[model samples]
Target: MRADHPLRAIRQLANESLAALQADFSALYSGMGRPLIPPERLLRAMLLQAFYSIRSERQLMERLDFDLLFRWFVGLGVDDPVWDHSTFSKNRDRLIEGDEAARFLSALLPQPRVKRLLSSEHFSVDGTLIEAWASMKSFKPEDGTGPGDPPTPGGRNADADFRSEKRSNETHASTTDPDARLYRKGPGMEAKLAFLSHALMENHSALLIDACGTRVSGHAERVAALAMIEAHADRSRSITLGADRGYDAADFVNERRSMNVRPHIAHNLTRAKGRSAIDGRTTRHAGYAASQRIRKRIEESFGWIKTVAGLERPMVRGVDHVGWGFTFAATAYNLVRLPKLMARVT
Candidate 1:
């Protein structure tokens, strides 16, 4: 394997940061018991799965057994015995419960180089739906009554009738993943069980500085965007926020201004009979146009996370688990981009 492989740089960075989380790992495992598979190694393996689009833990372990590149990225030697897929799954559940993935991303932001590259003034926000693992049949009343039964001996979901049912989050819930809500992005689109993922990306480097996942709802995007932008911005300084027409709300714009942040949200003018929340006062600035141009870059991050990382329909069920996966995927996107940015600086 080449020494200068792109992943080798990621491995070096992972090792440096993993070492710092030693104490956090210690708390997850008792000192007296048989030593568990190292949390750091488990996380590294997960990163490999995200990077290479490995479908499952079993498949990842299988690759680690023989593939030199997979072993190298995961810090396993040629003769090292790979953990059983079930054990890896159990350990991952523990890690997810502890929210390590989100914390790992948090740790990365404070690093000197990453902090320097981050643009504190100009940022963009957007959200996408992460289709849940559940099926339409699983969405039923919280009282245990479902739409209909599936015929046996016809494979899974053979005869379930989910059509002609008016299901809403208020009246129905997914038995498999209660946190997932039935949502559709627009008219004529089929509603599916899904969660909302939001990202706050800086304009200069188009790097994701913050991200979050939430239960799908109409106002969730605007609510999450405001919270993430506020958290990322310096309170003393006025920052500019770029967003899509979905964020063009009077209340959201007013709130951004109250925080001393300029709302450069895209205007949502309707030809029929609606005025935009944003006026020429904000849109007249040249920076507003520049912010609009850079804001679309956030979609690149989303596209990679969904297609490359296979987060379009996560196997895990639950808001926290889904959120952690989204957060880790965002972190992986940054890791891939950071190496290139660092090389340019040198």
Candidate 2:
């Protein structure tokens, strides 16, 4: 009974990973009184909760209050009442919106010279539509009370005298989830007011270094991948980037070339599949073609976010909030991932 406990093991892992991140580099929310909960524990719990898809701060708070392992992961004792869930939704933006996770993901996955056996640095970049939590339902064609106001005499029908009408992104400014826009990237008519999330993780380490939340289509995937490159701020010839067909655009290739990094991007050969051949970009050059082979690794990053960070869709409304949310999830991902990576190196 006197020996080290299960919770102790979990706490050690959580704190180690947290220590890898830099929450202080942020210049956003300063002088916000004394911190009530330890930043590391609070951040880790958010990561765990997001990964499990558990919604609401109250739910997270309840779990932490009850789960001994979770308490330990955050370094709270069995008797400690973890901070309430609202703390996450409230304070998280300040910590995550900027350099928090990237600072840590970067520190944990720095490139090593003569470390020829590692595969984590070989990254694949891809992006997906994180369906917005808001609704086009708010985009009514007729006037109505702004959220909680009340029905104006009669906006019940289109024929009625109305001050406003439900307008799609094709028109009027939205009073709800205004930052979201209708986006359809799927094969069919399906679309969403989506925010895009992109990640760059070490293939072997599974440690994510850079991530971005954006709404611009056509180029969003490549833009995010480029952001990762820029964040690393590396122009060294040793780094090679991977990405799917979405990034097969000429600009991406030129951009990578300008940076002195190799682009192993897949060829967008959808039109020539049966008409032409199986391989596209990878077939063009020995290195380009070979580089494209590993772009699939980036998909694993998003998989971890939705699977482990509870962010298949954001809980918040605006693009800014969704961006913040993705950052939190990314930070959470690192918190969970760092421990396992350390275990390997140790």
Candidate 3:
């Protein structure tokens, strides 16, 4: 509450972000349970812990009990009781993914009289690897033991074809985690089993319209990119899909075009030259080049999700739970973005 205190800024940011989420979530979450804790307060506290790297549920609880701003964000007045961290983790499971976060984001899409930062038409697409909650060590593949068996103990590094070896973290490994898999940009390298998170960002305002995380591909960048076409399909039927070199595959390009979407994916020099190229004839599209240039900025949104927002590794096991965590993180990120989005508005 002290104006001079450093945490005041944190509290204000946390409060505003939570307030936005509260409005979107209130009606839908009503029957999920009594507002066990004010969703805004609890969510803001979670965001603070993540952004500040507080780490672990216990640490978040301790801070809430002692820190004033945290207390305020979690809706605890001086005399009110603070909810336990477990209460949060418990109710959080009820939060939805796939559609829930998207719906909340849709609600906050725009305010009256506010012009959008990025025009719906001027958007870019990209994806990033989110290391799962499992470790390569614990994920050793099962030796042909069964159809969906775990990797054998010592054989964790067996296949150069698997994506687990390259993407798994060696520097700061997690103890409670056993499901993490390694992944890399290239194939035949199983570094970490990862979730591919694709995001579609409106360039000028950097608002994210859609995001989908998957566990199947090492190349989620291209996979989640189908989103651009799907979302834009009903709007105009014909749209430009911009992306990086990873999306320079024949099938991916063909797939986008078939949907009536123009593929503005960057040309991969290595593949663009030889006999492997998409025929020099078909490679000539100006819009494609322009789209490639703007694709880098798209990475910003995902960067914020992984680093600034602390979603690099999922919070829970199974793709579904991890997906749930990402939805909340994305919702939180948009809340942080709302002020910037509305800043220039009259």
lDDT of each: 0.87, 0.61, 0.61
In terms of TM-score, how similar is model 3 to the real structure?
Answer: 0.73
Q: Write the per-residue lDDT of candidate 1 for residues 205-306, one digit (tens) a residue.
A: 898888889998889999999889877666688899999989998899999988988888887875346788889889999999999989999999999999
Those runs of model 2 whose alpha carbons end farther than 4 Å from true positions after fitting are 1-14, 20-35, 97-99, 110-121, 140-173, 232-238, 270-290, 334-346
Worst-scoring 10-residue span by lDDT in model 1:
154-163
Candidate 3 displacement at residue 25 in angstroms: 5.8
State each candidate's clash count: 0, 15, 35
Better of 2 and 3 by TM-score: 2
| Model 1 misplaced regions, further than 4 Å | 32-34, 145-151, 154-156
C-alpha positional error of residue 106 in candidate 2 after TM-score superposition, expressed in Å: 3.5
Best by TM-score: 1
TM-score of each prediction:
0.95, 0.75, 0.73
Q: What is the full ranking by lDDT, best candidate first?
A: 1, 2, 3
Q: Write the per-residue lDDT of candidate 2 for residues 1-346, one digit (tens) a residue.
A: 2344433433454455556554564344475786655566666676567656777788888888888766756567987666756666666665655545555444434433202224533555677778888765545432443344355555552233234544455563445666667777867876566778777765555555667678746677777788777654366545667666667666777777677656666556665442322235435566555556555655666777776666777677777677666766765665555544455565
Question: Model 3: per-residue lDDT, tens digit, 237-263?
Answer: 566766676777888878876777666
Candidates by TM-score, descending order: 1, 2, 3
